[model samples]
Target chain A: MRAFVLFMCLSVGCLAQRPQPCASPPLLTGSLSVSTQSEKLMAYANYYYDALRRRIRLTEFGSYNNKTFHLDVLLLYREGVMYKMNYKNQTCCKKPLSADFHPLEIPWNASLLGQVVIGSSSGPGQGVLVNTWEGELQMKEGPAKYMSTVTEFGCIPVSTLFHTIRSGWMVTSFFNNVIGLVDPQQLIPPHFCQGAQLEERLDEDPVTFFSLF
Target chain B: MRAFVLFMCLSVGCLAQRPQPCASPPLLTGSLSVSTQSEKLMAYANYYYDALRRRIRLTEFGSYNNKTFHLDVLLLYREGVMYKMNYKNQTCCKKPLSADFHPLEIPWNASLLGQVVIGSSSGPGQGVLVNTWEGELQMKEGPAKYMSTVTEFGCIPVSTLFHTIRSGWMVTSFFNNVIGLVDPQQLIPPHFCQGAQLEERLDEDPVTFFSLF
Candidate 1:
């Protein structure tokens, strides 16, 4: 009886110690196509990254119930600020830096979950979904306790274009076309609004994680 | 300039007021096939619901990194307890009741995001993924916010099967067959182990939400 008991202990112990299968982080840069999908709506976005400069540009287009929504932001780490520019409306809004918004930080070291490559059969290529990267990116700063898949490329290659599922938001992002290098000149806007269209804004209300649908 | 400011306010307000598209709670009873996917693993589980009797049975099979995992649980709200019976290992375990463990208490009223029905080409039927009600269901209990969609069947049928993208865990559940009614006898195990195989245990550590991956 004692020997049988010992065998049971070892069996359970072995099962618990089994190793998980995941690849180390791959080289990732950026992309132009990313989208978010929920039960009712699908929104598409674009991203540009200057890895050496640690800069990011994001533009999101959400059309639901016949109304159009847009968020265009440029994050310049060197300047320590984030700018929300709407090209269509010809307005540029600037917000100061705070703990809540760090657009340049990528959660790559978080445990890897898996890899997914999606393609369209008829189209010549594909586009991954890019996250707008709004709200408290600080939630990612906690210890990495869970395992999830990361893409090799896109706005944040190692990060999902969408937010985490834990936030009561299950938004996901995907992109397809792979552009090799972004020209430095491409990062510059043709013009920054100089007149009254440039609005200086303070920290707007921080979006509660749940408020992001 | 004042006219332009008023127009801007109206534009933003109009965009914000656009109504979300969602149906009311769906009348969903049970499903046969549901699967969960993460970066490293994919787990499939089935559920049997006796809605009238308020009983549920879940059987899950997972194959990860060449290892297989199985969980069989019987939840009888009437008895005010839940049972985990492992037929393969010939062991049965039980856990105490808490507001956190009620799998049948659908968070229908919590919030509604959207609804999805997935089916394969070969199978004509469809199923909604019912979470076995494991892990910290506490994650589902919180103030509801966000506007997505809801199904017509579930408590919030217009809502999502399970929260799609939060908790550092993106658990997607899919069922192919819609089982109308569960016969009561199906809920009973053929036999309970008479003596030694039944191990009396306390609340084993509740699985972290990410561990479900």
Candidate 2:
């Protein structure tokens, strides 16, 4: 059959010529579940990254019904500027490293329900791996159809950083590591964190830190 | 011919069954361009809304080369919380609005350069409508492709609130208004502007005011 239709059109053009996750930017650590309920366990985040020095460090501890919670940040981006240290309230803010602070943008998976299907690069490891196409999300006032699953780790793609109707209250990032490495004093601000001022200075404007969530 | 391939598969399934410009939530004002560079006006933004009381108010002015900038915010949102105040230096923050604060989730068209197509909803006026299918944004480092257009009104969609790669140097809300009406004392915090505290509370784990941009 004409060489099986030219070998299925050259293997669908070499899988549509791959490369589209976000180009290249994943060196991460994980643990997510910003808590929207359902399976329970209100909070618990944990990040650590390098993604070509966009640098990152997060630590969230949880406890809802009983009241325990904590947060620690360190965003440093360097050359392009992005500082935002605040380890346990030492405070320090600055901005410029745009793309909403890339770090692959944000959405870190958003859990695994099913059905988003963005270009579908599919099941792989390390870099250039996209995937979205499965999709559900219909909730106008709840319950109708809500299953989602956004993928990608290297290039970047959690449905372009989240919100497939909040993938049933998030929980992706069970664990990940692009080759690990993060502990240059966790970025900065710790020598007794004494007077660390400078609370805000957003210059490159990324939605004014749009709430850093 | 099989009824013309069943009328071209029911017109490509009615253009893929329309309705995906982000389900509900978009009654936004405008002003975006967080400055990535291109045009002249390095910054500018305007917004005001009620959206059934989800409340919102924004003001952004810019000058760049001569240095003259300003920012005022209000964002309310109730029932799911979202606060944010900040009129100049007044500061007041709180979080919980979830879906990234929902002004259509924040993207706000981004800018016009390449690939971003939503539907083709076309411009006419108010409510439910949506669009985006004009797309093109491939850039990894500098120009290679970047045309985008995202659309919506009654449920918001300036690319979900704005950030198209920062149009050359941004300055996007030339002017806009859902119907005006943002004078609820600009959401309070001006008895003399003297020490308006409360700058971060984000309870819903949206990343803890990552900067509230």
Docking class of 1: incorrect
Q: Taking the tens digit of each residue's C-alpha lDDT, what string does model 1 give over A99-168?
A: 2333333344443332322111111111111122223333443421222222233223222334455422
Which window of 10 residues has the lowest lDDT sum in candidate 2 chain B? B119-128
Off by over 4 Å in 2: A1-9, A12-14, A17-24, A27-33, A36-40, A44-48, A53-55, A59-65, A73-130, A133-148, A151-155, A159-186, A193-213, B1-213
lDDT of each prediction vs. the true structure?
A: 0.40, 0.41
TM-score of 2: 0.24
Candidate 2 - chain A - TM: 0.32
Q: Which candidate is the best by DockQ?
A: 1
Residue range with the least summed lDDT across 10 consecutive positions in model 1 chain B: B118-127
Please provide, for model 2 over A30-88, each residue's C-alpha lDDT reduced to its tens digit, 9 standing for 90 to 100. 44444432323355565666667666667666765667766565666564444555545
* Model 1, residue A99: C-alpha shift (Å): 5.6
Q: What's the true lDDT of residue A120 in model 1?
A: 11
Model 1 lDDT tens row, B39-116 = 344456655655455566767777665588777776655654566787777776665433233332333433322222
lDDT of 2 at B147: 25
Here the TM-score of candidate 1's chain B is: 0.50
Lowest summed lDDT window (length 10), candidate 1 chain A: A118-127
